[model samples]
Target: MKVQNKIVVVTGGGSGLGRELVLALLSSGASVAAMDINAAGLEETVALAGMNRGNLATYALNITDRAAVEALPEQVIARFGAVDGIINNAGVIQPFVRLKDLDYAAIDRVMNVNLFGTLYMTKAFLPHLLARPEAHITNISSMGGFLPVPGQTIYGASKAAVKLLTEGLSSELLGTNVRVTVVLPGAMGTNIAVNSGVMDTLEVKGGEAPVKMLAPDKAARIIIDGIENNRFRVLVGADARLMDAVYRLNPQRAARFIYDQMKALLPQ
Candidate 1:
């Protein structure tokens, strides 16, 4: 579906790729409702839109809250007239530790924010999207969802669940007006560690040959293009694209390669 004139809601719109998506959508003539937990960040996103600010609305929301997510459709419609698409972009990572060392509270937090959050938002807005003549839903998974990273096992698990959930949703919505797309993003230049509150415990160190992370703006563009074309899966960054092929050809080798690269961060 084309984005022009459509009203779309994006979670995690305070910063990172989510913020970029809001800006891109506005530039493409789409009205956006940017939702995030950080009010200041949302304000900053709108401010960055400048003249296009009128096409954007900011909402400070915790997507994990089912009641709040369920109520969002009405609020968004009141602000933007109608909801045509939703991007479930908010997520968190687990601490850099083995699952044996990881606490239940931390595991629960990751699952709640990453998996349940996406599920809640999808369920809440699916009806509204189906009502639209052309609508789309985009869920952001991660490269870790397909390949294993030693220290980020739980985070990978959460994202892997999202990968399946999105694919299943796409299959189920096949006959409907709503289109579902899942995004698998590689490492990107974003403050996800800070946002996930894992910065102190988890430091992403560069290897001997450092991998260049993709920019948020570029990632956003790729995602938007996928949505416009109603693609079932969107892979962001060269790393993500490479892994997609690697995983398909040899899943075990791909998992081992990632484990070797990331095992340094794990507890010795």
Candidate 2:
């Protein structure tokens, strides 16, 4: 998907990796509809891109709102004439807490934004995508999607769903012009903690900030390239790849290692 002048929609386009992806797409000459719940952040992202009119647009809407998402395709078509791709990037991560200790509201919020949001966006834009010759859908999962995170169980579950969903969609769309790609990103230098409203509750394990935190810009580039080449799976950093390798080699042992490594971050 040489994104030169193609139309792309990125959820959570207001900040963090989503923002970086939007910028990268615009730089590649793609007409973008940057959507996010945070209107202010979306405006800021547009300002940063500095693209000419018609090259970039902002949609301040919640992905979890099915009605809004359903209407997006029409709006996008009106502006760009067609939808070429969608990056289901909007997601939220709560503080590391065991399932038993987590509030039901928190669990629902995470699932609504992370899992349901991805589904809503995918379903809404899929028809439009099918109309294109080489349309793509990139769903951003996490390392947590592959290996279980003891404390952040709900988050892990949501991303895990994304992992399977992306793969299943890929298989289902095998013979179609549309393609599905999944992205598993290890820790990256982004404002996810702050933006997700969990910064105050976040706890670091092993008395360290955590390793393999790639910069958002680097992650964005990898994502773009994956979409361009129609990759099935793209791991953001070495940590994610290593974890995936271990998990595939021995699932139980990988889970144990993750539990042990993340012991400190668990609630007392």
Cand. 2 TM to true fold: 0.96
Model 1 root mean square deviation, Cα atoms: 1.5
Q: What does candidate 1's lDDT look like per residue over 126-216, in tens digits?
A: 9888888889999999998988878788999999999999999999988889898999999998898899888776545553323578999
Candidate 2 per-residue C-alpha lDDT over 1-268 given as tens digits, one digit per residue, 9 for 90 to 100: 7888899999999999999999999988898999999999988897898745458889999999999999999998998899999999999997777888889999999999999999999999998898898899999999999888887889989999999999999999999999889999988989988888888766665447746579999999999999999899999998898989999999999999888777777778
- List TM-score per model, in order: 0.96, 0.96
Q: Evaluate model 1: give its lDDT.
A: 0.91
Worst 10 residues of 2 by lDDT: 203-212
Clashing pairs in 2: none
Instruction: Report the error of model 1 at residue 259, Å.
Output: 1.7
Candidate 2 local lDDT, residue 110? 96
What is the TM-score of candidate 1?
Answer: 0.96
Clashing pairs in 1: none
